[model samples]
Target chain A: MSAPGSALIEARGVSVRLDGRGILTGIDLDVRAGEILALVGPNGAGKSTLLSVLSGDASPNEGEVTLLGRPIGDYRALELARLRSVLTQANAVSFPFRVIEIVQMGRNPWMRGSTVDDDREAVIRAVEAADVEHLLGRRFTSLSGGEQARVSLARVLAQSTDIVFLDEPTAALDLRHQEEVMRVARGLAAQGRAVVVVVHDLSLAGAYADRIALLDSGRLDALGTPAEVMTAERVSRVYGLEVRIHRLGASGRPVVLPLRD
Target chain B: MSPRIRAVGLTLLLAGVVVGGIVLSAITGQLAITPTEVAGSLLRAVGLDTVWAPTDPIVESTLWFVRFPRILMGLLVGAALAVAGAVMQAIFGNPLAEPGVVGVSSGAALGAATAIVLGASVLGGAGIAVFAFLGALLATLLVYVVSRAGGRTEVVTLLLTGIAINAFAQAGIAFVLFVADTASREQIVFWQLGSIAGSLWSQVAIVAAVGVAGVIAAILLAQRLDLLALGERNARHLGVNVERLRLVSIVLVALLTGVAVAFTGIIAFVGLVVPHIIRMIIGPAHRGLIIASAVGGGALLVLADLLTRTMVAGAELPIGMLTSLIGGPFFFYLLWRQRRRSGGWA
Candidate 1:
């Protein structure tokens, strides 16, 4: 699909209007294989909206989305789902499912003709990949919010599709879980999966993202490598706060730290 | 717990209860028939002709026709309501939802009440069932419309609105009950308080058709429901048609509940209790939960009815009263346990 390693996701001038107001406007972006594209912006900057549209979850009012060179609307629901997996913002539900049951739901889109053995192997690997092996047998409801998020990541990983969208995956995570999640993200990209993530942590984005896409006021503020895009001026303008960009001694990549008033 | 253990455990429990309930129901009555006589009577009615000891029509009729059909109707309606409760709990993402919570049961009652008031039974065979189905379908639509005003419904909000609508429907029934004559009053009491007495084979077939259909449909939709339990926005992100699933489930619950109330009147407690027990045991996987709820409900209601009819010779207590006597405390127990487990006032 889409030349095997070429742009797997292409959005052409897409815009989204929620209720009666425009929330996202004229967004054009493409994601390719073995690439981690980080979407970063202030709250309500349509970062999540852009991600949702790109993942083919929500429909856009003004433009078209093509994944793997085919119109997204033309693909069957399970077909589209089999090609991509999404981990949304931190959310909770009332049902008290077990951790394994939660992970097994990931196999639904692909379990149409597969054997039971296939699904079991995928689930075990996914649980291990998310570093939730210790938490596998525990109750999902009894877990803390951060722990639940990790289990949810295990679920999405069990889905094991070629495209992944992570919306603020590390927003609620502790420092260790944050690194653990992004390491999984990077690993997926390394395996030729197109991974697009919306991360609030600028430093994490600097370290993990192949290219960063910055959104401001429903517009693309900047899109480039961490070295080219994450300037002190750009951070100050986008966030309306003073910021400092420091380069790591080993990698020479930008790391942002905010300077508060 | 492992899924296998849960499945086998529920199966054994439901089987023991069902067999015991059947035996108890078969023996309890004014007729004073032996277990052998009752079995022979049933077998002969099915054309065995082996029970040749002067098969008095009255005794035979009461045993083969009355008690058996009543038992079958109880099983059908109970299973329908209970499975509906399980699905509703999953769909609404609230543990408290059952057949009665979402106005489906009340709507069914209203339909039957309307049929009784209108003398639809005079039109013969299918009239009561038709009117009941219409009443249920309409009430479900109303609940859905009110819940959809802002384009989404919180589980709590939908449940509370269901309570309000149920209260309003009952008020209408009360209005009808107020102006009715004595014969109709007895009929209304029987219909309102819930009873399996006076059930016929014809009615059993009708309720079973709709109830079984609804339950099977619900079980089939369990996979999609897994995605739905992720909550609305995330469910949509996972490529599930959330609105369509909601509509289908609500309509199915309505139809099954409508047919159930049309025949069995208004049996309560089974729906809510059965699902709660299943969830408590299995930790809320809809696939197994729905099936377990159905089997458990069928067995429980049958057992409750068996006790109700046997409690007094020559007279039957209201089946609903018996269920409430047993189920009310059980309901409170669940609330207490859930509150304790949640470790808060929620």
Candidate 2:
């Protein structure tokens, strides 16, 4: 249902400079409605920096960022908060809060009334969608790391925003939860929302993302369909690792199978 | 115990303590009024009549003048300190955090001391309150800014900055004490020892008002505190205006700390000790911890003050001494308990 050529977000020549050093420079990117973009990069590739700018959590040193056709800075806090949500790689949570209670925090952007039924409904749906409904009543911090990740996923699912920014959202998860997160992000894209994820896992990104944007040394190395962008040559060049790209049957999606040296 | 059962048990015990503490505090004193007499006196004072007749004028005077204000101030101070303490802990993200432990109380005390010694008589009634508030605000802002100099402000950095500021401020106060005249010395002494002595009705009224406002604000912000418990980055991702939340909460806690320190002087430990106790009862959820600690802290302080007054005859010890006596051991006990549980403090 995505409108043809309707850009959900547009960043033009966006550059980020922090602490007397340039973290990202000469970056231009766009994502259309209903597309899942994987920001793939090695460490220190400015994937987090670019995600930070797009989610309105950080600003570009030069040029500009626009979300949903509006300048990032011009959007009111509530407006910006309502339109997008971010899930960073690491979270330091303390003490135990009921899973449902933790998930209800996603409603902070829209809650005007005290009645939390709608919020709870959203949480329930998110938890069910994330396959963590069994852990809804459990304490969040008490859960395993993988379980906490799923609960946090339920939280953003409850956020139910048009654009979701995930900065290495599955970095702490095991293999199964990593797949679950990719599946969820892809599902969100299928529902006509834009999902941008920063990932180190070449295989996961290749499997789920409609397009892969490879970042190297804070610059865009490649940005195109998974088939076009992900090749053994590019992977080895960017990540300094021997990697083979297996073109999976039918979908024509490139499955990255790294050839260890 | 499971979290749910522990929560329920703590809630009941805290309520019992508060109710029992308030009733006992209000009803008993050196004058030895019966429960009926206390009830009747309160009823008539508030324009509600029961079967009991009016007590003697002197006893009535005692009720209206001494006991009532004392109890109210205790409740205000305890509640204010606890709220401020909880906010500090949340902002600093350390369970050991306290309003005074971070220099907020002493800073307010220094401002109040300066106001009195300099006779900033123009401020008159509001003089001490304003000075205390300013001092607290300055200290809080200083700690926050100093800790942020390197583009990062974490819990450990903020706590250490607080320690450094507190040490420097105390050293300055000592210099002031060394150079002061007798009258100023006595006043500073009283302030340092922290007495609720000479708590006039108006003063009590101010403390109550500010304390209530502070506690209410904290309670309303309980959700943000909970989100914040997840840390700054996590909080921002959840749509919390991380900087704004930090700024507002720090300012609010400073205001409450200043007001509490202004009138009550440098009462210690209630803020730090009480909330930790409450968290042990209610678990770490700030939503429940803030409100429960407010009520529980208020009750504890009022009761402690009542003990301070009646603990000895013909002489009133500084309330600071009393709370320190209690808090110092409680602090050590927490250390010991933590040692036993985890083998060492983090």
Give the TM-scores of the predictions, in the order they appear.
0.93, 0.92
Name the top DockQ candidate. 1
**DockQ, each predicted model:** 0.61, 0.51
DockQ for model 1? Answer: 0.61
Return the top candidate by TM-score: 1
For every candidate, give the share of true A-B contacts it also has: 0.50, 0.48
Q: iRMS of each prediction in angstroms?
A: 1.8, 2.1
TM-score of chain B of each: 0.87, 0.88
Give me the chain B TM-score of candidate 2: 0.88
Poorest 10 consecutive residues of model 1 chain A by lDDT? A1-10
Sort candidate 2 into its docking category: medium
Fnat score for model 1 = 0.50
| Whole-model lDDT per candidate | 0.80, 0.79
Return the lDDT, model 1, position A20.
Answer: 78
- TM-score of predicted structure 2: 0.92
